[model samples]
Target: MLYFLPEPPEYAPPPRAVRVPAKLSVRVFPEVIAMSHPYELAPTRPLSFERERGITEVRFQGGLAHVEVRLPGRDVEAERLVLLQAVAEAGLPVLLIKLHPGSVSFALPDAAIAERAERLLLGRGYIYAMERDLALISICAGAMRDLSGVMAGLYDTMDKAGIRVAQTGDSHDALFALISGTNAEHSARLLRQTFGLPEGGTSC
Candidate 1:
């Protein structure tokens, strides 16, 4: 978690020079002033459409698979640890890990790793499900941590566009969602338009 203190209503004036006693025979100087407060010094101007929307870019990554492992017993923590260790031992790199009441889910970079992970789980008698041909769409912003309604707006746009999101994640600067690989390009285009981003703003 992070906390942002409000900027002071007014900038503090620079310090004045102070006099030293003759007995000390020392000259005292105020510390050099640092940069001014951004809130006070920044220029005031109308924000561009994209800047106002806060979204800076849209990114896509294709050829990923989503997997979920079900922990059926009472010790879900132990089960989760063992499952993760098994994946690590198999040398499968996972992303966007999420925990549910009885299951843990993550994304694999490619189908080969997904298949290998599934085989490992099956051999270890762990129940799981895997979905292939998924693409990750990232909505990047300058201040996502402070933005409101961005996620809701994103989901609403996707719902209207008939894009079904399989998994989601977020960070201080971006939001991520996994959708069908077939919809990757279209989803990126739609999001760019919806957020008022310039054409060709997406990168893979």
Candidate 2:
């Protein structure tokens, strides 16, 4: 699907990207190019390894869950505050959140918290859904949103590898994808291979 950077006054410039050829690239990320246009994935930043782990260690964090809600309100910020308050009261750790027109999808630390969330949020002018056994994967880079084909390639990689994504969110700084906890390792391996990064850090 058609998915959605800056700065010239750099302290240090970003590394040149490795280009995926259109022919081989399209086979890998066919969903990226819908129209007859051309784009390039800018160079990746050569990571500074003071204590950097590189792309190895396909790590997956467990004990995560998500909650989706639809409430009628124009003030997104106000709604967010309300949701955060409710989640906090439930003793669940809120991870990432995405807001649509009147709908919001957010994640918590554990599935058991759903009981508190539903009890607290339901009948309070909101329809909500809660899910558990989820893992979050996020990639952050400078100006990733502005880079064309990057997201499409990501989705394509998941699709080919048979990774089922539970939810996705994006901001100016990062891209987040939630997948089955069981599939986290496979998905992480696919992500590492997709980016041509070195493997073997700690876990997968």
**Model 2 segments more than 4 A misplaced:** 1-58, 73-81, 88-91, 123-125, 140-150, 170-174, 202-204
lDDT of 1 by residue, 1-204 (tens): 999998879878899999977686654333334448743333334545544347789888899999888897789898889889988988899999999989999999888888888888899998888999999999998778888877887798899998999999998789999999999999988888888888665443
Q: What overall lDDT goes with each candidate model?
A: 0.85, 0.69
Residue 32, model 1, lDDT = 31
**TM-score per candidate, chains pooled:** 0.71, 0.56
Candidate 2 achieves a global lDDT of 0.69
Give candidate 1 regions above 4 Å deviation: 1-53, 202-204
Each model's backbone clash number: 0, 2
The candidate that achieves the highest lDDT relative to the unseen native structure: 1
